[model samples]
Target: MTETDTLRERVAVELTRARERTLTLADAVDDHDLVRQHSPLMSPLVWDVAHVGNQEELWLVRDVGRREPVRADIDTMYDAFQHPRADRPALPLLDPTEARAYIRTVRDKALDVLGAEPLAGRRLTTDGFVFGLIVQHEQQHDETMLATHQLRTGPAVLDAPPPPAPDVPVDDRAEVVVPAGAFTMGTSVEPWALDNERPGHTVDLPAYAIDAVPVTNRRYAEFVADGGYDEPRWWTADGWAHRREAGLTMPMHWHGDGTATRFGRRTDLPPDEPVLHVCWYEAAAFAAWAGRRLPTEAEWEKAARWDPATGRSRRYPWGDDDPTARHANLGQRHLRPARVGAYPLGVSPLGVHQLVGDVWEWTATEFTGYPGFTVFPYREYSEVFFDRGYRVLRGGSFGTDPVACRGTFRNWDWPVRRQIFAGFRTARDVA
Candidate 1:
């Protein structure tokens, strides 16, 4: 039909899919399971689910001209910041059925209004921002819920393997060599990227040879076999200390038998599959053992996206369509890491495999602000992580929201913490 009709249809589909995702998540756990908190900081599943629904109402109905769907008490039940995790036990409980109903009602109202309106050119302002944020927020909850279930429930149900990678023809050695040049990094136009990727700036990168594909399990296995973990020479002093403290011998999900198994599902570590679950130290050691280094954040960004005109500043590696399954492993049905090299089209201009998904690739640059960098109006996102030590990780993982998987999206984890879905690729400065 018309463009407006098309937009409405897409919105309807998104709402329906979100509702289905919520239902699936709710059904996966029992009421008893919902009450239990997996971590001291994380909210209980029931509260989290309700919070997702409540967010929809707050943004769409209250903020977007639609009528409020519930009593004001609903706010008190789901304000996460107001009702901290510590206070969850003391807060009034919401029956699971009632909470689900409220969520469904909010979704239904949003669908109705969106379908009726002609919103093609209408610039989304505050309420629209909330709508997008809530959708992504729910997706994040979906991932966290799965992680919580894994932690709380025994591995029996939680340990199913991620689905097989979609059969895309892969040429294992198809490499893209990037000639070095100066480029502007980060997002110029702010749509929905987090504060960390904001206030795009320029960066110069030297000519470097980066692997066409992420380091594979087979490749990393060679390093491990050669005593990469035991040798301190390969690791930075800080990395060495972190490794010693954690007592890590190999990648987190890798088994003694040498197969890459995640959540208890065994898959052949295809030589072509990008190596995953590696922390920064492990990545550095692997690079050292292999005579290479991890790409600097600027170098990685340049290879991913190269702007031709100014010879500076690139937006996305694959030129910015947002990430799709055809492009990357993000937003897959399986809630775990994927085999690297699965998505060829998603490769950066430099031909790196799985740059936007499968796993987050750790970069060499420490987390710091660009020149003239200022905190966003919202403080908690990036400002808290600006200490001297933390390193940047580019490319979102399979567990990340597809909408959130922009080339500019910047994530950082402590070099020592390997529990999260993090991995790395290598880059060597040209000789």
Candidate 2:
């Protein structure tokens, strides 16, 4: 294929992949489940299904395609900012069958837009950036829908094969010591990179050591055994208060027994699996108890991407190649985090394994924009969340799709949020 043909085909493939994945999640439930809001935190699944189509039409058909709105009447209903998620279930949303048809119609028009734009020109078509953005956006909502699945009541509606049992045992003492250096952080030329990761800047980080693998179930269980929750010395006053009020003695979805609950059900906690569904506050407390600290966002990035020998960074911990099952547990291929140290092939330049997939690894930094950050397409997508209250979470979870995750891609949430798929590793500054 020619370069132009290659780009066009690439965009088509990504768009198809994204739509298919969205449909997979949307189809898993019956019509009743689709229209019902599973949680106050999430929009109804039907809303997400139609909203995905509406967003594509707004961007591709109206903005890029220069065509009329697909359904102007439903615009306000789908406008996320205009109507909060809690109120969406009450809105006059398209029913499941109608939503299905509506989304497909918009998609057909979006495909037409894709054909007209060679995707090499400037603006939204530049490098097929808008299509890339839409794919990522849909994938993100799918992840959110996955979160809603977790919060919903009843038997597990979604199921996936479990990742392979741990073949590679992690050395508890394994910590990669990164030498102090200035590393290029974030991306500048990555075509689909969001504005938050733009304008690559140099971050001078001091020598520090980060764990080779994420904190394991057995490790976090030990913290719970040590009264990590009851002890105030180990927690910030706010975290301590929150933990007590919420009565969180262990990681969310974890029980006093060996059971580790996930997605509306409970299962035995594999002692070796990377701990999942932990909040930032809980992670920080555990780090305090361990006499270590969570890695700063810069430190985490450096550990995951910096190559001191080359004085540069790689696109992913395992390098520029796109992710695969052997590389990491991504794209909802597995329902749970693989055992820590399992994906040796996904290790970083300094040998940090599981940096890109599994539970999102929390960092010490707040979610803020990089230098020269500019809002694109819409401000609500990212800018609204870049506040002091939200902490940054690096890496992606098993539920995260390739379209929604990259080394530079950033995810954030309130520190108290535990219903989300998140985990963390500890770091210690070199003395």
Candidate 3:
């Protein structure tokens, strides 16, 4: 096959994989739940369902293909920046049946464009970046919809077998020291890397120790038991206020009796599973209580991608390869994070485990563009969100699809957001 044929095949496969996931999550819930706003922090599931199609219609069908509008009337209704989540349920949204049909039509047209359009000549068409963007966008919504399921109060509508046990015995409390050095950070040539992740740059840093695996329920529970939340000394001024205001004493789904809610069912918290649904403040407080700190974005990336032996950075912790089931617990294959010691092969050269998936590890860095960052496609995608109010969360969560998760891939949210599938590992500077 020619290079163009190969590229088209890869893009087609990814787009299909992402769409399948989107439909599965949307179909899992009944129409009532799909339309219901599970939390103010999230859009109605039905809205997300329709929005992904609208995005594909706009970017792929209309923009890239130069085709006429599919559903121009409802475009404003689905504009995320135009309407907040809290106001969406009250809007005239497409019913479940209509939403599904709408996406089907959009996808049909999009695939036609995929087959006919030349994969070059236009900036968006170059290397199938627009298709990649749409795939990642849809997968991101799938993850968001999964989070909505976690927030919804009802019988579980989703189920998956638990993630496999550790391939090899793992020490739950181990830490790996990333020696002081400079390493290339971010992506210079990753085809689908967003504007914010562009322009790879060298970042020099001092030695620091990072947790080999994410912080687990067992360890975080110690923080709760020792009054970590009550101690202001362990929290920033803003974090202390938010903690008290929100009554956050433990992880979002956790109950005092060592149980946590998962997909609407109450189950005993698996002690070894990486803690999930934590805000940046909670992660920071826990780190302080444990006499460590959250790793900076640079520190976290270096630990995950910098290979001391080669003096180079890799696309992922394991290497420059797409993730598979054996590498990390990604793509919603399992609804929750795997055990702390799982995915021995996913470990980085520096010994950091589960850096690409499980939970988004909160970092000390604020959301900002890297050095020489340039906006491409659009500014709203990432450039507009460079405000300091948002904290950076490196690593992907179990719900994240591999197409959307890479070492340079970055996710960010307000520090007070606990609805996201987030957790953290602590780090300490070497003396």
TM-score to true structure, per model: 0.80, 0.97, 0.98
Give the C-alpha lDDT of model 3. Answer: 0.92
Better of 1 and 2 by TM-score: 2
Q: In TM-score terms, which candidate is top? A: 3
Clashing pairs in 3: none
Error of 3 at 67 (Å): 0.7
What are the Cα lDDT values of the candidates? Answer: 0.69, 0.87, 0.92
Tens-digit lDDT track for model 2 on 1-431? 77777888988898888888889888888888889988787899999999989989888899898998879899888998899888888898999999999989999999888888867667778888998988888888888888888877787878888897657588754798999879989999888998888879998878999988899888898998998888999998889899988888788777779997687678998887889888999999999999999999998898888876688888988888888889888898888899887888888888888898889999999998887788876788789888768999999999899877888989999999887789999999897
RMSD of 1: 4.2
lDDT of 3 by residue, 1-431 (tens): 98888998999999889989888988887888888888988899999999999999999999988899989999999999999888999899999999999999999999999999889998788899999999999999999999988999978889998898986766768999889989999988999998888899999999899998899989998999999988999999999999999988888988889888999889888888999999999999999999999999999999999999999999999999889999999988898899877898888998889998999999999999998988998989998899758999999999999999999999999999988999999999997
Model 1, residue 355: displacement in angstroms? 1.4
Tell me the deviation in Å of residue 78 in model 3: 0.6
The list of candidate 2 runs beyond 4 A from truth reads: none
Please identify model 3 stretches exceeding 4 Å from their true place: none
Give the range where candidate 2 is weakest over 10 consecutive residues by summed lDDT: 164-173
Candidate 1, 1-431: lDDT as tens digits? 97556655655565566666667766776777677776664567788778887877876666564675665676876776577676785677677777777787777776666655555344453223444555666876765665555445334344334545747655533445677566778875756555677778867666787777667767788888899999999999988998898888998767757675554355566665666677888888888888888888887777777755446444556774655557766664665655655666766655666667777888898997777666653455578678758988887776776755677778787776565577777777775
Q: How accurate is candidate 2 locally (lDDT)?
A: 0.87
